[model samples]
Target chain A: MRIVVVAGGVGGARFVRGVREEVQRHRPGSTVDVIVNTGDDWWLAGLRIAPDFDSMLYTLSGQNDEERGWGRVGETERVSAELHAYGVAPEWFTLGDLDLGTHIARSAWQRAGATPSDVARRLQERWPLGVTLHPATDEEVDTHVQLAGDSAGEVRELHFQEWWTRYRAALPAARFVQHGIERAVPSPGVLDALLDCDTILIAPSNPVVSIGTVLAVPGMVEALTAEAAPIVGVSPIIGGSSVRGMAEACLSAIGVQTDAAAVARHYGLRRDGGLLDGWLVGLEDATAVDALESEGFAARAVPLWMRDLDTSAALAAEALDLALALRP
Target chain B: MRIVVVAGGVGGARFVRGVREEVQRHRPGSTVDVIVNTGDDWWLAGLRIAPDFDSMLYTLSGQNDEERGWGRVGETERVSAELHAYGVAPEWFTLGDLDLGTHIARSAWQRAGATPSDVARRLQERWPLGVTLHPATDEEVDTHVQLAGDSAGEVRELHFQEWWTRYRAALPAARFVQHGIERAVPSPGVLDALLDCDTILIAPSNPVVSIGTVLAVPGMVEALTAEAAPIVGVSPIIGGSSVRGMAEACLSAIGVQTDAAAVARHYGLRRDGGLLDGWLVGLEDATAVDALESEGFAARAVPLWMRDLDTSAALAAEALDLALALRP
Candidate 1:
């Protein structure tokens, strides 16, 4: 079986881990291809930092910090501290010394003319990740957020990282803009993964920036609608709140309600010329299933809290089951 | 009083510290400008690795590992280890985490169109390094060493760092070639420091790749000979051997004997259209003093071992006194 997953950073990494676990246990020999959003990537101290890609790499390789919920375990910030001392900007986003190895290697490879896909392949070679990670696009389409309510109509644009990591998403965002998105084509292998896969799953990542950015790629929507592969999405929102991260702020920026049914409607139904064939909402939001089904989605209420590996695996199984059921 | 010193890496850094100490104690309010060699610099993983400049910075700021004879005092190699694990080339040369900060900052600034001189000024701002440091040349003049004998005449050239750090200077070098020396001009303030100073002292650095590369800059020799600031050089060779590092290997590569008088002759006398007006040899090389004098250089033999700050300061004073006596 071949499966394609669209993902963001931390939440996406966790969800992918669950997907991998479920595939390994039940669907042996299944291949999982992850299409990671690169919208959060930015240049720091001249290094190319792909937060989502690194999260996927670290988490899948079992090198990720479980306690801190991000970055590599046993990581040191010596270099980051020194960068801060040197007065390098964006002091808020601190990269670990171990993690910097990834950025440095990636930057070096990129500088040597390797595309994002090439770098991803090289990075993945370092570990037996079991899944292939593809950058959503080779083009630089970093998400920049425009803050709301600027006096005198003055515009304030901040990189998604600055708005998210630095400000913790406290600042009200008017809109999220992925620079160069209009011209971005799906990275190498992305189209093949989507069209050739048996099922396509959207991980519970940020709807506004993560999965949204991937879908926003010029040819992505066309390719998705072109395929008969069952498209299933797990809700990042549960019981009117995000399962992880500040997806609420991101959704609110685009005026989407922080509710499972609303998020399902946001992705909409394939029959209605939108994305999902099936939508999995949390058990806490079981009441929204009828409304979602009424709106033409193959909606199901399941235990969505991925607190540990088993739980994540179970949630992933539920999503896969829903995808299979929705399959024509 | 304004003084200029031409220097290299570790040896030069130590010598400059002494010069700074001596000037502070004896000639209060005096300014010392150091023209640092950039020949040893190379791009590592896209970061500009300026060994000599960093040595001066770390040493002057008291952050250098004195016992290990290089890098930051409490350095970690997490990033470097990662780089190695990632299979980045030149695994022999490892940069410490704290040290990488400087390189990253420098690479960023250079990428943003800041020259070496501008970066130097900004780096100096971090620490109260009393002496002002200037790169020998604004242009890239990385020294490449050609191995003495290549089988089948397949000429092999390695970057100076690879030769010095990786091979430990054991690979017999045929000649040292500065890649862009032909068109290279001194970096900003290098000529001014040479021409406008009251005295000029050549640090007991590597004569071939360090001080030699500085002199190799197109207008450097002209500026040195054009000035009457009494150019005095302290010999890096003592007792028919180099005081530190592998200066003997370098000197032999260029067909210069590893002897104090030979090195003095190599620099030649300012009267004979060479650089030095005065030459300071170690007390062990006292026998060469008379020959040096006969060769048109005012020669002196003094205790030259910089074992401690006091001894280094004393040596600096001796070099200063020699320069002043040779003044026109």
Candidate 2:
């Protein structure tokens, strides 16, 4: 199966990591392609640090710090503190010592006139991925969250990490803006992977922000809509709450209800103008099954908890099966 | 007296750390000016890393790691592991976590088009050195050391750290090349600081590279010679041994003797016919005073063992006294 999986940082890397484990057990020909979000890239100190891309890289390599859900396991803060001594510090960020190296390499490559796509390819070359890994866009397209009033009056754009890590996403989110998406082209093979793939699985990632930002990039939504090949999305929000992060906060900001039916409805059905060929909700939200079917979209209810690799693989397999069944 | 120090990392930084303490004990208006060598500056992983300049800054700020002698205290190495995970490693050289922050800030400033001098100013703005700090040259001129035949082997120029840290300077040194020094201009205010100085100190830094690289800059030797201010140098070598690193390997490479007297004679009364009015040799090498004098340089013996801050200051003061006394 030529399966393309689009993912964000923590949750996305985790789900995709599980996908790799499942595929390893199957025949060697089932290739897994990962399209990671680059909306969380930031310049810390002098390094062009790509948080999401690195999280995905670490996850796939089995080097990720499980406790932090990001960064390397045995990370240290020596260099960060040394940077503080030089007085260029945003000391609150938990940038593991090991994490800085990826930023360093990526930044160096970019400075030397290499594109994000070029940098990503070199990194993936080491893994060969059994599948290919790709950044969603070559140019930076950060997803900034606008939060309700404090001193800035109505809203201010917060870097995704600021919204997620610093505020823990408790601050009322307004809407997520994928800044520079208009200028960003997909990382070389991204569009091809999505359009030419046998199946495209949008994992249980944030709908209004994470997945929404990926779809927001100028022509990306058009490409997915044009693809007759099955495109399946698993609801990140189970009943009405986010699996992680402030998806509910992001959903409310965009005026979309946070329930599974609302999520499938947000993607909408084929005839009514949306991207979902099929949608899957967790078994707890079996009621959304009827609503999705009535709206003329193929929908199913399954267990969505990523408690272990086996469970995540089952979720992926179910999503892939739906895509293969939808195949014309 | 307003004192200015010309330095690189390690030996030079250690000297200036002592100089900073000496200058503080003097009456008000007595300031120290530090001119750090930027030839060693490199853009690693996109951060503008000035190893020597920062060591001085941290030492002066009273936050240098006494154990490492470079980098900051309470530093961590989590970033290095992250770099390894990405397979983007020059693992041969260590980039402490806190140390990476300094590089990040400098890299950002430079990327935004700030010169090394400007970044240094920004770094020292909050620190109380009461002295002006400037990089010798704002250009990118890395020092490359060519070793004769060894494990890494022939015709290759090792980056300074690879030569120093990795090989431990064990290979026969062929020649030291300061790449790009010919095309460089002294950072703004550098020559002026040298020409307007009361006394010029050639800190007992590794002569073949560190301090030598600074002196090799096109107009630098001319500026020092043109100034009648006593050009006094403290010996980095005592007896036939180096105070640090492999000065002997370097001295042997140039066919120059490795004793205190030879180091004094190598810097001699000049670079291309210029010479110091005074040279300070360690007490253990008191016998070399006559030989240094035979080379047409007035030399003095002082206890150069920098066991503690006070002694280092005393040694610095003694050297300053000899320079002042040697004035015409």
Candidate 3:
């Protein structure tokens, strides 16, 4: 069996871990491929940093900080402090010494003329990550957020990291823009994974800047609407709130309501010319399932809180089952 | 008074510290400039590294690890370990986390169109290094050592760092080659420092790679021969061997004996189209003083072992006194 997952960062990493666990236990010999959003990537101190890819890599390789919920375990920021001392900018987004190793290698490879896909392959070779990780696109399509209003009348736009990390998303965003998206093509193996997979699952990542950015790639929507596989999405929102991160602020930026049913409707039903064939809401939002089905989504309410590996694996199992049921 | 010093890495750093101390105590209000050898610098993991400049920076700022003889006092190697794990080349040359900060900042600034001099100025701004440091040349003239012979009939040459760090200079070198020296000009302020200084002193650094490479710059020898200032050199050798590092191997590679008299003759007398008007040797090599004098050098034998700050300062003061005595 082959499964393809669309993902972003922390939440996405955790969800994909669950997917890997579920597949390893029940569907032995199955291959799982992840199409990770690279919109959060940017150049800092001349290093190419792909936050989403690093999050997924660290989490899958079991090197991630479980307690802090991000970055590598036993990490140090000595390099970052030195950079600050040298007056390098973007002081808010601290890079741990271990994380910097990855960034340095990526930047070196990129500068040596390797594409983003080539770098991903080289990085993944360092560990047995169980699942293949492919960038959403090889082109640099860093997401920049336009500020809604500024009383100072200056500095109205910021890279997604500056907006998210430096400002903590407090500055209302007018819209999220993916620079270079027009010239981007799906990374090697992304389309193959989607077209040849038995099922497709959207991990519970940020709907606006994460999964939304992935969909916004010129050929992405066309590939999804081609009916290659049954697509099911797990709601990042449960009981009208996000479980982690600032997905609510992100959804609000794109004028999407912070509700399970609203998110499902945002992705919409494939029969109605949208992306998903199935949608999974949390048990707390079980009441929204009937309305979602009435609106043409083969929707189900499941326990969606991925508190531990077991709970996460169970949630992943429920989503896979829902997608399989919707398969023609 | 304006003083200029030609220097290399560890030994040069120690010598400069003494020069700084000597000037502060005796020649009050005197300005000291150091022409640091950039021949040892090379790209590692896509970072522009200048060892001599960093040594001067750390030592002058009191951030050097005195016990270890190099790098920042409190240093970590987490990033280096990660690079090793990723199979990045030249693993023998490990970079401490703190040291990497300087390299990253320098590489970024250089990428942003800053010249080597500009990078050096910006880096020195972080710490009040008592002396101004300038690269020998602004161009990337990294020294490569051509191996004497290879049994495999391959790999005839290696970067200086690879030979020094990886092989520990055990591989006999045929000759030293500076890749971009023909097109190189002295770095900004280098020729000015040489031409306008009241007196010039050569630190007891590696004569072949450090002082030799500096002199190899197209305009450097011409500037030295212009006779604007009296030039004095302190022999890097004592008795029949180098006081520190592998200067002996480098001397042998260039067919020069590792002796104070031999080294003085190598620099020769400025009257005969050479660089030095005076030469300082260790008290142990006092017997060679008369021979040096007969060969047109104002020779002096002093306690040249820089075992501590006081001794180093005394040696620096002796060299300055000798140069002043020969001021014509």
Instruction: Select the stronger candidate by TM-score from 2 and 3.
Output: 3
For each candidate, what is the lDDT? 0.91, 0.77, 0.90
Ranking by DockQ: 3, 1, 2
lDDT of 2 by residue, B23-48 (tens): 77863566667777765666556566
Query: How far in Å is the alpha carbon of A126 misplaced in model 3?
Result: 1.3
TM-score of each candidate? 0.98, 0.87, 0.98
Q: Quality of candidate 1's docking, in CAPRI categories? A: high
Question: For candidate 3, what's the TM-score of chain A, rounded to 2 decimals?
Answer: 0.97
List DockQ for all candidates: 0.88, 0.54, 0.88
- lDDT (10s digit) by residue, model 1, range A247-302: 98999999999988888889878887899899999999999889888878888999
Worst 10 residues of 3 chain B by lDDT: B148-157
For residues A1-328, what per-residue lDDT tens digits would candidate 3 score against the true structure?
7888999999999999999999889988989999999999999999999999999999999999999999999998999999999987567998999999999999998999999988999999998799999999999999999998757565478899999999888989988998779998887679877776788899999998899999988898777667567999999999999988898889998899999989988987787789988899999999998988888888888999999999989998998898788777
State which candidate, 1 or 2, has the greater TM-score: 1
